[model samples]
Target: MFDVAPTELLLVAVVALLVIGPKDLPRAMHFVGKWVGKARGVARQFRSGMDTMIREAELAEMEKQWAAENERIMREHPPAPSLSAPEAESADGADMHDLPPLMVAQPDIRPEPVAAEAPVSEVEEPKTRGQGEHPL
Candidate 1:
Protein backbone atom coordinates (compact mmCIF):
# COMPACT_ATOMS: atom_id res chain seq x y z
CA MET A 1 0.00 0.00 0.00
CA PHE A 2 2.89 2.32 0.72
CA ASP A 3 4.40 1.62 -2.76
CA VAL A 4 7.86 1.33 -1.11
CA ALA A 5 10.42 -0.77 -2.97
CA PRO A 6 12.24 -3.63 -1.21
CA THR A 7 15.36 -1.43 -0.81
CA GLU A 8 13.24 1.39 0.69
CA LEU A 9 11.55 -1.11 3.03
CA LEU A 10 14.99 -2.44 4.16
CA LEU A 11 16.16 1.15 4.80
CA VAL A 12 13.07 1.88 6.88
CA ALA A 13 13.58 -1.34 8.85
CA VAL A 14 17.15 -0.39 9.61
CA VAL A 15 16.05 3.03 10.80
CA ALA A 16 13.31 1.47 12.92
CA LEU A 17 15.80 -0.94 14.50
CA LEU A 18 18.09 1.93 15.44
CA VAL A 19 15.29 4.07 16.87
CA ILE A 20 13.18 1.35 18.50
CA GLY A 21 16.21 -0.72 19.56
CA PRO A 22 16.94 -4.35 18.72
CA LYS A 23 15.47 -5.62 22.03
CA ASP A 24 11.91 -4.28 21.59
CA LEU A 25 11.85 -4.37 17.73
CA PRO A 26 10.14 -7.75 17.52
CA ARG A 27 7.40 -6.70 19.97
CA ALA A 28 6.92 -3.43 18.10
CA MET A 29 6.70 -5.27 14.79
CA HIS A 30 4.08 -7.62 16.27
CA PHE A 31 2.04 -4.67 17.56
CA VAL A 32 2.28 -2.91 14.16
CA GLY A 33 1.17 -6.10 12.41
CA LYS A 34 -1.91 -6.36 14.65
CA TRP A 35 -2.84 -2.70 13.99
CA VAL A 36 -2.42 -3.20 10.21
CA GLY A 37 -4.67 -6.28 10.29
CA LYS A 38 -7.37 -4.36 12.20
CA ALA A 39 -7.12 -1.44 9.79
CA ARG A 40 -7.54 -3.80 6.81
CA GLY A 41 -10.60 -5.42 8.45
CA VAL A 42 -12.23 -2.01 9.11
CA ALA A 43 -11.46 -0.88 5.56
CA ARG A 44 -12.95 -4.07 4.11
CA GLN A 45 -16.17 -3.62 6.14
CA PHE A 46 -16.44 0.04 5.05
CA ARG A 47 -15.96 -0.94 1.39
CA SER A 48 -18.70 -3.63 1.59
CA GLY A 49 -21.13 -1.19 3.22
CA MET A 50 -20.47 1.43 0.54
CA ASP A 51 -20.99 -1.20 -2.17
CA THR A 52 -24.37 -2.15 -0.64
CA MET A 53 -25.45 1.51 -0.52
CA ILE A 54 -24.39 2.02 -4.12
CA ARG A 55 -26.35 -1.06 -5.24
CA GLU A 56 -29.50 0.16 -3.47
CA ALA A 57 -29.22 3.60 -5.02
CA GLU A 58 -28.73 2.08 -8.48
CA LEU A 59 -31.81 -0.14 -8.03
CA ALA A 60 -33.92 2.86 -6.99
CA GLU A 61 -32.74 4.85 -10.01
CA MET A 62 -33.52 1.93 -12.34
CA GLU A 63 -37.03 1.62 -10.87
CA LYS A 64 -37.67 5.33 -11.40
CA GLN A 65 -36.43 5.14 -14.97
CA TRP A 66 -38.56 2.07 -15.62
CA ALA A 67 -41.67 3.81 -14.28
CA ALA A 68 -41.03 6.88 -16.43
CA GLU A 69 -40.51 4.70 -19.51
CA ASN A 70 -43.71 2.78 -18.75
CA GLU A 71 -45.65 6.02 -18.51
CA ARG A 72 -44.17 7.28 -21.79
CA ILE A 73 -44.99 4.02 -23.57
CA MET A 74 -48.57 4.06 -22.26
CA ARG A 75 -49.00 7.66 -23.47
CA GLU A 76 -47.56 6.82 -26.87
CA HIS A 77 -49.75 3.79 -27.35
CA PRO A 78 -53.12 4.34 -25.68
CA PRO A 79 -55.15 1.32 -24.48
CA ALA A 80 -57.46 -0.51 -26.88
CA PRO A 81 -61.14 0.46 -27.14
CA SER A 82 -63.03 0.05 -23.86
CA LEU A 83 -65.04 -3.18 -23.49
CA SER A 84 -67.92 -1.44 -21.71
CA ALA A 85 -70.99 -0.36 -23.77
CA PRO A 86 -71.60 3.35 -24.29
CA GLU A 87 -74.16 5.17 -22.12
CA ALA A 88 -76.23 6.51 -25.01
CA GLU A 89 -76.54 6.94 -28.79
CA SER A 90 -78.05 10.02 -30.59
CA ALA A 91 -79.63 8.27 -33.62
CA ASP A 92 -83.34 9.08 -33.99
CA GLY A 93 -85.75 6.12 -33.28
CA ALA A 94 -82.77 3.77 -32.94
CA ASP A 95 -83.10 1.80 -29.71
CA MET A 96 -80.08 -0.02 -28.16
CA HIS A 97 -82.31 -3.09 -27.65
CA ASP A 98 -82.90 -3.30 -31.39
CA LEU A 99 -79.29 -4.30 -32.03
CA PRO A 100 -78.76 -7.94 -33.05
CA PRO A 101 -77.44 -10.32 -30.37
CA LEU A 102 -74.17 -10.97 -32.26
CA MET A 103 -73.51 -7.21 -32.66
CA VAL A 104 -73.71 -6.58 -28.90
CA ALA A 105 -70.68 -7.46 -26.76
CA GLN A 106 -71.35 -10.46 -24.56
CA PRO A 107 -69.84 -10.94 -21.15
CA ASP A 108 -66.77 -13.22 -21.02
CA ILE A 109 -68.32 -15.32 -18.28
CA ARG A 110 -70.86 -18.03 -19.02
CA PRO A 111 -73.34 -18.79 -16.23
CA GLU A 112 -73.58 -22.34 -14.91
CA PRO A 113 -76.74 -24.23 -15.96
CA VAL A 114 -79.12 -24.73 -13.04
CA ALA A 115 -79.78 -28.35 -12.06
CA ALA A 116 -83.34 -29.65 -12.53
CA GLU A 117 -85.09 -29.37 -9.19
CA ALA A 118 -86.68 -32.47 -7.63
CA PRO A 119 -90.46 -32.50 -7.16
CA VAL A 120 -91.57 -31.02 -3.83
CA SER A 121 -93.56 -34.21 -3.01
CA GLU A 122 -90.50 -36.47 -3.64
CA VAL A 123 -88.09 -34.46 -1.39
CA GLU A 124 -88.50 -34.31 2.41
CA GLU A 125 -88.25 -30.64 3.60
CA PRO A 126 -86.37 -29.75 6.78
CA LYS A 127 -88.63 -28.73 9.63
CA THR A 128 -88.69 -24.97 10.42
CA ARG A 129 -87.12 -23.82 13.68
CA GLY A 130 -89.08 -21.69 16.15
CA GLN A 131 -87.57 -18.74 18.05
CA GLY A 132 -84.50 -20.00 20.03
CA GLU A 133 -85.51 -23.60 19.32
CA HIS A 134 -83.32 -26.20 17.58
CA PRO A 135 -84.93 -28.07 14.70
CA LEU A 136 -84.77 -31.84 15.49
Candidate 2:
Protein backbone atom coordinates (compact mmCIF):
# COMPACT_ATOMS: atom_id res chain seq x y z
CA MET A 1 0.00 0.00 0.00
CA PHE A 2 2.90 2.33 0.69
CA ASP A 3 3.92 3.40 -2.87
CA VAL A 4 7.70 3.39 -2.26
CA ALA A 5 9.80 3.35 -5.43
CA PRO A 6 13.31 1.79 -5.67
CA THR A 7 14.93 5.27 -5.65
CA GLU A 8 12.93 6.36 -2.59
CA LEU A 9 13.88 3.15 -0.78
CA LEU A 10 17.57 3.67 -1.68
CA LEU A 11 17.38 7.24 -0.40
CA VAL A 12 15.83 6.17 2.88
CA ALA A 13 18.48 3.45 3.31
CA VAL A 14 21.32 5.97 2.67
CA VAL A 15 19.78 8.44 5.18
CA ALA A 16 19.39 5.71 7.81
CA LEU A 17 22.98 4.59 7.30
CA LEU A 18 24.21 8.16 7.70
CA VAL A 19 22.03 8.97 10.73
CA ILE A 20 22.36 5.62 12.52
CA GLY A 21 26.04 5.21 11.49
CA PRO A 22 27.45 2.01 9.86
CA LYS A 23 28.73 0.61 13.24
CA ASP A 24 25.24 0.41 14.84
CA LEU A 25 23.17 0.09 11.61
CA PRO A 26 23.00 -3.72 11.72
CA ARG A 27 21.58 -3.76 15.28
CA ALA A 28 19.07 -1.00 14.42
CA MET A 29 17.94 -2.88 11.28
CA HIS A 30 17.48 -6.09 13.32
CA PHE A 31 15.32 -4.22 15.86
CA VAL A 32 13.22 -2.68 13.05
CA GLY A 33 12.82 -6.09 11.38
CA LYS A 34 11.51 -7.64 14.63
CA TRP A 35 8.95 -4.83 15.09
CA VAL A 36 7.80 -5.14 11.43
CA GLY A 37 7.31 -8.89 11.88
CA LYS A 38 5.21 -8.29 15.05
CA ALA A 39 3.09 -5.64 13.26
CA ARG A 40 2.43 -8.03 10.34
CA GLY A 41 1.37 -10.79 12.75
CA VAL A 42 -1.07 -8.47 14.52
CA ALA A 43 -2.52 -7.32 11.16
CA ARG A 44 -2.98 -10.90 10.03
CA GLN A 45 -4.76 -11.82 13.27
CA PHE A 46 -7.08 -8.79 12.94
CA ARG A 47 -7.94 -9.69 9.32
CA SER A 48 -8.73 -13.31 10.27
CA GLY A 49 -10.95 -12.20 13.17
CA MET A 50 -12.84 -9.83 10.83
CA ASP A 51 -13.28 -12.64 8.31
CA THR A 52 -14.65 -14.97 10.99
CA MET A 53 -17.16 -12.33 12.14
CA ILE A 54 -18.28 -11.74 8.54
CA ARG A 55 -18.82 -15.46 7.93
CA GLU A 56 -20.83 -15.84 11.13
CA ALA A 57 -23.00 -12.84 10.20
CA GLU A 58 -23.61 -14.37 6.74
CA LEU A 59 -24.60 -17.71 8.28
CA ALA A 60 -27.03 -16.02 10.68
CA GLU A 61 -28.57 -14.08 7.79
CA MET A 62 -29.02 -17.27 5.78
CA GLU A 63 -30.68 -19.00 8.73
CA LYS A 64 -33.13 -16.12 9.16
CA GLN A 65 -33.98 -16.22 5.43
CA TRP A 66 -34.56 -19.97 5.60
CA ALA A 67 -36.86 -19.58 8.61
CA ALA A 68 -38.88 -16.85 6.88
CA GLU A 69 -39.21 -18.98 3.74
CA ASN A 70 -40.31 -21.99 5.80
CA GLU A 71 -42.97 -19.87 7.52
CA ARG A 72 -44.21 -18.56 4.18
CA ILE A 73 -44.48 -22.05 2.74
CA MET A 74 -46.33 -23.34 5.83
CA ARG A 75 -48.84 -20.48 5.56
CA GLU A 76 -49.37 -21.05 1.82
CA HIS A 77 -50.05 -24.79 2.13
CA PRO A 78 -51.83 -25.80 5.36
CA PRO A 79 -51.39 -29.37 6.63
CA ALA A 80 -54.06 -31.96 5.81
CA PRO A 81 -56.19 -33.26 8.71
CA SER A 82 -54.97 -36.59 10.14
CA LEU A 83 -57.50 -39.43 10.41
CA SER A 84 -57.52 -40.76 13.94
CA ALA A 85 -59.53 -43.92 14.88
CA PRO A 86 -62.45 -41.94 16.44
CA GLU A 87 -62.58 -39.43 13.58
CA ALA A 88 -62.55 -42.19 10.97
CA GLU A 89 -65.42 -44.04 12.69
CA SER A 90 -67.51 -40.86 13.24
CA ALA A 91 -67.12 -39.66 9.64
CA ASP A 92 -68.01 -42.95 7.86
CA GLY A 93 -70.08 -44.64 10.68
CA ALA A 94 -68.07 -47.79 9.90
CA ASP A 95 -66.08 -50.07 12.20
CA MET A 96 -62.31 -50.43 11.85
CA HIS A 97 -62.75 -54.06 10.78
CA ASP A 98 -64.91 -52.94 7.79
CA LEU A 99 -61.93 -51.04 6.28
CA PRO A 100 -59.65 -52.84 3.85
CA PRO A 101 -56.23 -53.92 5.08
CA LEU A 102 -53.44 -51.30 4.56
CA MET A 103 -51.21 -53.76 2.73
CA VAL A 104 -52.47 -55.62 -0.39
CA ALA A 105 -51.13 -59.00 -1.47
CA GLN A 106 -48.14 -58.58 -3.84
CA PRO A 107 -47.44 -61.12 -6.56
CA ASP A 108 -44.21 -63.11 -6.38
CA ILE A 109 -41.62 -61.25 -8.53
CA ARG A 110 -38.47 -63.34 -8.07
CA PRO A 111 -36.15 -63.57 -11.10
CA GLU A 112 -35.80 -66.88 -12.92
CA PRO A 113 -32.64 -68.91 -12.41
CA VAL A 114 -30.05 -68.59 -15.24
CA ALA A 115 -28.65 -71.69 -16.98
CA ALA A 116 -24.96 -72.53 -16.41
CA GLU A 117 -22.57 -71.22 -19.10
CA ALA A 118 -20.22 -73.50 -21.05
CA PRO A 119 -16.62 -73.68 -19.72
CA VAL A 120 -14.01 -71.67 -21.71
CA SER A 121 -11.24 -73.67 -23.50
CA GLU A 122 -7.61 -73.07 -22.62
CA VAL A 123 -5.54 -71.02 -25.16
CA GLU A 124 -2.16 -72.21 -26.50
CA GLU A 125 0.84 -69.89 -26.05
CA PRO A 126 2.51 -68.56 -29.23
CA LYS A 127 6.20 -69.41 -29.85
CA THR A 128 8.73 -66.70 -28.94
CA ARG A 129 11.28 -65.23 -31.41
CA GLY A 130 14.16 -67.15 -29.78
CA GLN A 131 12.36 -70.47 -30.48
CA GLY A 132 13.18 -70.55 -34.22
CA GLU A 133 10.58 -67.82 -35.01
CA HIS A 134 10.93 -64.30 -36.50
CA PRO A 135 9.50 -61.37 -34.50
CA LEU A 136 6.57 -59.53 -36.15
- For all predicted structures, in order, the TM-scores are 0.56, 0.62
Model 1 poorest 10 in a row by lDDT? 87-96
Q: Candidate 2, TM-score vs. the true structure?
A: 0.62
Model 2 segments beyond 4 Å from truth? 87-136
Clashes of each: 0, 0
Whole-model lDDT per candidate: 0.90, 0.92
- Candidate of highest TM-score: 2
Q: Give the Å shift of residue 112 in candidate 1.
A: 24
RMSD of each: 14.9, 8.9
Candidate 1 lDDT tens digits, 97-125 = 77665567767998999999986676677
lDDT tens readout by residue for model 2, 2-108: 99999999999999999999999999999999999999999999999999999999999999999999999999998889977553563667876788878978998
Q: Model 1's lDDT to the true fold?
A: 0.90
Superposition error at 27 for model 1 (Å):
1.2
Model 2 scores worst on lDDT over the 10 consecutive residues at 83-92
Q: List the residue pairs that clash in candidate 1.
A: none
